[model samples]
Target: MGLFGNFVAGGLAGLAVDLCLFPLDTIKTRLQSEQGFFKAGGFSGIYKGIGSVLSGSIPSAAIFFIVYEGFKAYYSIYPPGSTSEAAVQAIASALGAIAACIVRVPVEVVKQRSQVSLDSTKSSLDVFRETVAKEGYHGLYRGFRITVIRDSLFSLLEFPIWEQMKTFYAVYYGLEKTAPLAGACLGGVAGAISGFLTTPIDVAKTQMMLADSDALATKMGLLQSLVRIGGQGGLPGLFRGAVPRVCWISIGGFIFLGVYDSALTYMSTVAV
Candidate 1:
């Protein structure tokens, strides 16, 4: 597929994956936000707001992928088929991640708010209603700036680190055919590291966007939340949701890379 096509394909794939497992994402967020891990049955706990989360991820993924791919292809230094420099690859990944993050901030602002029932207002439908009622359309986009910064960091670490990790695995395993497996492992590693690093920021962002209640209002605004978490939980508070996010995204990455690589290979074969 061409760059745009690849993006559309990848975005659609991400949407599907996210939709199927949105409940995991919702649970993970709530578990992180309030330690609501036991609120649901065993494995099913990860799926708290599957319905609401879907409303956000499906369209968001497609738009993000298109933006990321467009920026990458346009700004890349080396021509297609050249020996890509590691530094260049890193820069490209960062750029692409930034682009994707910028596009995605709004969706994330919506998703997290919809996921947790910290307040009586949860569910995408209700969250949308409440946001529109209170904050208007722009209210739904609250905390988008922080969301971009936070997820941009994820993009920076995830893509470049993933590239390096996969390279290491492919060389170490000496099985070109198994590179997808290697890539999946690398994706997991990158997601884990990035998720932990970004957890506090994620928490703060979520807190900011959630529907305003006296409880939440008293709880913390953006700056105050940062201070409270820092004072009490320290760095750990920020990463409260890391474990589940890492696990959730890891499996998603595995499935994503598996299909992505397989698709690429088939495309190459047909082109040849």
Candidate 2:
């Protein structure tokens, strides 16, 4: 598909995924939050920042797939079934993640802040404007470095594993390509792995983003944040929300990639 198609499909898929599973994401954030799980709001609290999440997810995902698919097309010179396919996809995914960071970082900051707000009544736009006013434009981009690291690693792990799994299914099942079910299943598996591996980084990124901008007190770097987290509860503290994170990401991957592949397939047929 062309870049524009990727943008639209990716946006729709991402929007659907995030909107459906935002409560889980909010739970994951709270689980990883410094507020501690009990104080982070319970079941109903999971939906606190959902509006912010949706507002950001659509555009963020669209931009991500635009870059990802564009790079994938540009790097598609390797022959089909070639050994380098996974490697090529990994490179493209990483590159796309880097570009995606530009939009994602701010959205994350707002979403996270809104989720953790004590008032619990603030809207996404309220949190966004407050952040901008309080911390200037840079406030929205807090934790940019760690965000890049977490997202890039997620893409690096997720796309390669997903592509390889699809290849395996195609070869073993003698299918022309992965069926939608196959893609969704494998995508869930890939997302689970990626989410687990990146949870520690995610912990640090969330802590940094949720840090109080009022006093540069939490302006710690990645290493510092990790150390601080370790101090809180040792290594276990770093992976505070592994269960919810994995569950949400696995489901999100299934929906996001399922819809994405389906959209691309539809687009291809239409073009033909």
Candidate 3:
């Protein structure tokens, strides 16, 4: 593919993967955001509101990927069909991820609230309204900036690294052996890497949204939460949901890459 084409390819692939499994993200966030140490919702609770997630995520992925591709094209420093520009591609992916996260934060808030708000009777609209009324309009976008940073950083590091890793694996093991499991491993590693690296911020973001409702005498800032977590649980405390994150990411990574690679190849032909 040409530079433009690669840009298109990478973005569409990312979006495709993101949309297919966005429900898992909603699940993951709620799981990570639960109370108590290692607090995570069970299988059913995480999977709640899958329908609503799809209603928003699929198109959101499309927009993210397209915007990412456009950014790649804009930032291209190499000629078409050249492999030396892999770094540029990586940067483009980062930019795209940033854009995607910014666009998706509100959706993230809604989807997460919808998934975890199981009061047995509150509908999605009810939950959304309550969130807005209680938290205000800006409340729906609580973690907007943090989410953008996390999503951008994770994508910037993970996607490009995964691409390079995939190439190495393909060259080392040949195409047949570098199958679903390989992709899954790459994803798991990438997830753990990004998740681990960003856990401090992740915890802070959660605490902010979570504790926003609490009218405690002691209100702590983001850095204070980090320090508090460190003081209380040390390093392990920060990564409370690391175990589930690894597992979820591994599955998601494999599915995302596998699906994207196959779908992109098909899309290339179909787009022609």
Candidate 4:
């Protein structure tokens, strides 16, 4: 499929996933925030920042897939059976993640802050303007570096595993290309694995984003933040809301890959 088609597919996939699983994402954020697990409230509060996620996810996913598919084509010079194929996918996903962060950081900043707040009535625009007014435009990108780091690892694991698993299924099991369910399963597993592994970094990212301008003065770097969280509840503290994250991202990945691949396949047919 062409870049524009990829963009549309990615956006739609992301929008669907984020909207569907936003409550889990909110719970994940709350658990990862400074309030820690118990004080973060119950499952009922999970949809607090759904608006921010939906708004951000559409554009961010579009930009990511546009770059990701473009880079995938560029890196296709490496033959499929070659070891370099994995390396190429990893590199392309990393680059795509970094590119996606250009838009993701600000959205995340607003989203996290909104999620952690007690006020459910506040709109995403309210949070954005407050952040900008309180800490300047740069405030919208508070955890930009860590956001990139977290998402880079996420895509690095997710895309490569999805592709490799599809190859394994097709080559070994003779699965047909029409089996989008297989793709969804592979994508869910990849996302679950990546989400589980990256929870600690996600914890730190959430904390950093929720930190105020004044708090930024005493803000911890990644390692320090991890250590602090570890001190709170040992290894589990670092993981925080890993269970919900895995669940949310797993389902989201299923939808994302299933829809993205299905859309591309349909588009390819239309083009022909």
Candidate 5:
């Protein structure tokens, strides 16, 4: 499929998956919050920041797929000498993640705060306004760098594994195309692995974004925040919310990749 096809497919897939699993995401965010899950509204208002996520998911996902597919196409033509297919996939995935983070970071900042908001009545708009008013426009992107790093790392692991698994399946079955069900299963496993492995980075990123303007976490770098988390809570602390995150992303990846493949297949046939 073409770049536009990728964009549309990815946007729709992201929207579907995000909306379907938003509650799990909220739970995961709260679990990773500095205030602890109970203090971060517990089970109440899991949909708090959905507006912000809804607004950003499509554009960010669209941008990612466009860049990712475009890069893969380019790499296929140019053929990076001696680089393994896994490495090439990793490079494309990281670049796509980096590009996506331009929109994803701000959305995450607002969405996380909203997820952990003390007041159930507080709207996402309120969080956005408060963040800007208190910390300027930059507040919306407080964890931009860390977010990019985390997502790039995640993509590096996830995309390559997912692709490799599909390749294996195709080769074994002698199939010309991978079914959506196979893609979903492989994507889920890859996402779970990546999500679990990256929990520490995600924890630090969450703390960084949720930190108050003058908070120590806000002032400290990613490494410092990670060290501090490890110091206070040990290994378990670093992996806090890992279960929910893995569950959320596993389900989300299944849906996202399945829908993307299905949509792209349909679009390709339609174009023909």
Candidate 6:
């Protein structure tokens, strides 16, 4: 599919998955919070920071798929001699994730803080304004570095695995067309694996994003955050929200990638 098709498909997919699975995401965030789940407002209002995600997910996902598809196209034209297809896909996915982080980090900061807020009346804009007032505009990007790292690692695993699975399915079934259900199932598996492995980094990212301005975690780097978490709660602490995260991302991946593939296929036929 073309770049514009990628953008539209990605935007639609992102919106669909995020809106549908926001509650799971909220649970994952609260589970990873330093104050623990119940203290972080628990299940009271899972949609608290949805506004932030709603505003950013489309553009961020659109940008990612555009970059991803664009890179793959470029590589197709000028093939990298020694690099394997999987390696190329991983590289492209990581780059796309890094690009997406420009929009995603700020959204995450606002969304996560809002998720843990005790006051249900606090709007997303209130969180935005409060963050800026207390920590300047930079506060919106509190976890930018770690977010980029975490997402890059995630995409590195997810995209390549998903693509490989689809390849295997095609070879096995002798099918030329993409099947949405198969894509969704494979994507879910890929996302689950990626999410499970990346839970520790995710936990650190969450802490960094939600840390108070004067908190030690705020001053700490990603490595430092990981170390602190490990020291405080051992291995389990590092993987705080593994269950919710895996569940959220796996289901989200099913929806997100399946929708993207379906939309892109429809757009391709229409363009023809």
Off by over 4 Å in 2: 81-83, 214-217
Give candidate 6's whole-model lDDT: 0.92
Q: Candidate 4 on 126-145: residue-level lDDT in tens?
A: 99899888889988888888
lDDT of 6 by residue, 1-272 (tens): 57889999999999999999999999999999999999999889989999999999999999999999888887764433224777888999999999999999999999999999999899999999999999999999998899999999999999999988888787789888549889999999999999999999999999989999998888888899999999999999999989999999999999999999999888988889
Q: What is the lDDT of residue 30 in candidate 6?
A: 96
Query: Can you give the lDDT of residue 77 in candidate 5?
Result: 51
Better of 2 and 3 by TM-score: 2
lDDT of 2 by residue, 1-272 (tens): 58878987898888898888988888888888877766767555667767776677778888888888877788788866576877888888888888888888888888888777767678888988998888899988899988898998899999989988898889998888998778988999999999999998899988888878753426777888888888878989988888989999999999999999988888888989
TM-score (all chains, Cα) for each model: 0.76, 0.95, 0.75, 0.94, 0.97, 0.97
User: For model 4, which pairs clash?
Assistant: none
**What C-alpha lDDT values do all the predictions have?**
0.62, 0.85, 0.61, 0.83, 0.91, 0.92
As for candidate 5, its clashing pairs are none
Which ranges of candidate 3 are over 4 A from the true structure?
A: 1-31, 37-44, 75-86, 170-188, 213-222
Ranking the candidates on lDDT from highest down gives: 6, 5, 2, 4, 1, 3
Stretches of candidate 1 exceeding 4 Å from the true structure: 34-48, 70-84, 101-103, 118-123, 172-178, 211-224, 268-272
The worst-scoring run of ten residues by lDDT in candidate 2 lies at 213-222
Candidate 3 per-residue lDDT over residues 1-272, each given as its tens digit: 44444445444545554556655565556645645422434455545545445555555555556665666667667753346556766677677666666546666666666655646465556766887898787776776666776777777777667766766787786564355557657765776676667767676666555444653312565567678777767887777666556655666666665655555566667778
Q: How accurate locally is residue 144 in candidate 3, as Cα lDDT from 0 to 100? A: 66
User: For model 6, how big is the CA root-mean-square deviation?
Assistant: 1.8
Q: Which ten residues in a row have the lowest lDDT in candidate 5?
A: 77-86
Q: lDDT per residue, candidate 1, 199-225, as tens digits?
A: 777777765665364445234555777
* Stretches of model 6 off by over 4 angstroms after superposition: 77-83
